[model samples]
Target: MSTSDAVTTQSPALSSEDRSARIAVTVFPLLILAAFAIAMITPDTFKPLAPGVNWALGVIMFGMGLTLTLPDFGLIVKRPLPVLVGVVAQYLIMPLVGWALCYVFGLPDAVAVGVILVGCAPGGTASNVISYLAKADVALSVTMTSISTLLAPLMTPLLTAWLVGNRMPVDGAAMDILLMVLAPVLGGFIVRFVAGKFVEKILPLLPWISVFGICYVLLVVVSGSVNKILTSGALIIAVVICHNLLGYLFG
Candidate 1:
């Protein structure tokens, strides 16, 4: 066949890799919304599971790890400056922005703390996909995410303690956060390493798994907040929207 003919025959739509990554990017938030809806509709069946929510987050982190390779780290080692800049930008920008917003808007303590928590969170795995879509530096985005997440066990608590200390009791236990977040991520990485070819074959399904995990977390949070939400629905929605928008803008 002519080269022109072959070129013409190629599909212009998204490749499998693109489609899977999109799903991975979207699943978590969608699940969160779905879970919240379920909780709102049937609170009895949707009792909050705080620990389970944590575990689901861990699973999502692990799924992220499974997609990584040693070279991803190499990017950091080779070009330390950009990665450092990204990490610093990530750590400083979000939390401070959140803090400023809370102060300026006169958010209550609990709501303020919630905003801080979301801001203090590291760059999510979804950011890599977003960066790709925006034609930004994917490597930098992934590196920032990986390093920030690895640092979460330390940074999250420290930032939380520093920002929300007056508002709430901050547990400055890096080890606990590490065990809660990194353990699952490392475990998933090891599993992927061991199952190499098998993992490659089933990689397409990771997005679905991540989506389910996120939904579970949202459900747990929403279920826990049902009474408060019912009583202060407008306030709760406002806080959530502001928190999310700020994270995206400053993240």
Candidate 2:
């Protein structure tokens, strides 16, 4: 082939990667925009969809379970101490930090509970990816996040009740929530155990599934926020930003 033709052929290949990178960059912001647009366009319509948050959470957990195996559990059994430390850190650090922010910033009751709820919640599945990107201990991170998440039904409600229950009236029946969350996860794990090769083949798409799930949850939350935003406006934004930034700093 002529040199010019060779370069021309390669140019298309290079542009494909560039296009993918651009899409990846824009996808999240676009999702955020769509979420806000939905919130504005049909706020009441999305209210009924709120229950889907729990379902989406379950699906995300199941995806996490699908990525696991017997060996992952064995790794936890083999090295209990570090895993224990990470789990403890995950539970205590985030909630306490959130509580302190509530007091320090003087957040009102409802917003304060929201902050505590997110904090009391277990480390997200995304933390494993973050740990990997940071070149930290991926296995340990996964183990800690998994164990903490598995325990979230009990721990999350309990901690939230104890800390912010008075403010927001937290229901202490965490076993119910736990069942809802873990059933899909355990089911996924069972599927992985029975069909390892099949699970492996589809594992590559799990992250995208998770991204979609997160976008759904964000939509629900933002939709809920529309009324509050309309009433409170920038003050709500300031409070939420403060809560999120503080949670990240302390988390």
- Best-fitting candidate, scored by lDDT: 1
**Which sections of candidate 1 miss by over 4 Å?**
1-17, 23-31, 48-51, 121-173
Reference-based lDDT, residue 66, model 1: 71
> For model 2, where is the 10-residue window of minimal lDDT?
12-21
lDDT of 1 by residue, 1-251 (tens): 99999999998988565687676565545656667789888876667367686667777777666766567667768889998888998889888888887887788887788788888888764564345434356556666776787788778878988999853344554445556555765676688778878777876766677666666766777777788789868875776677668756765
Q: Residue by residue across 1-251, what tens digits does model 2's lDDT show?
A: 99998888773443432343345445756776787788777877777889898888788767767766788778868889998877887678778877887888787887788778887887664565334333355456666766786787678878888888553344554555556445766788899999999887776566556657767877787778787778866765676677667656765
Positional deviation of residue 78's Cα in model 2 after best superposition, in angstroms:
3.0
Backbone clash count for every predicted candidate, in the order shown:
1, 0
Model 2 ranges with Cα > 4 A deviation: 1-26, 124-146, 149-173
Looking at model 1, report the run of 10 residues with the lowest lDDT sum: 166-175
Q: For all the candidates, what are their Cα RMSDs to the real structure?
A: 4.2, 6.1
Error of 1 at 170 (Å): 5.2
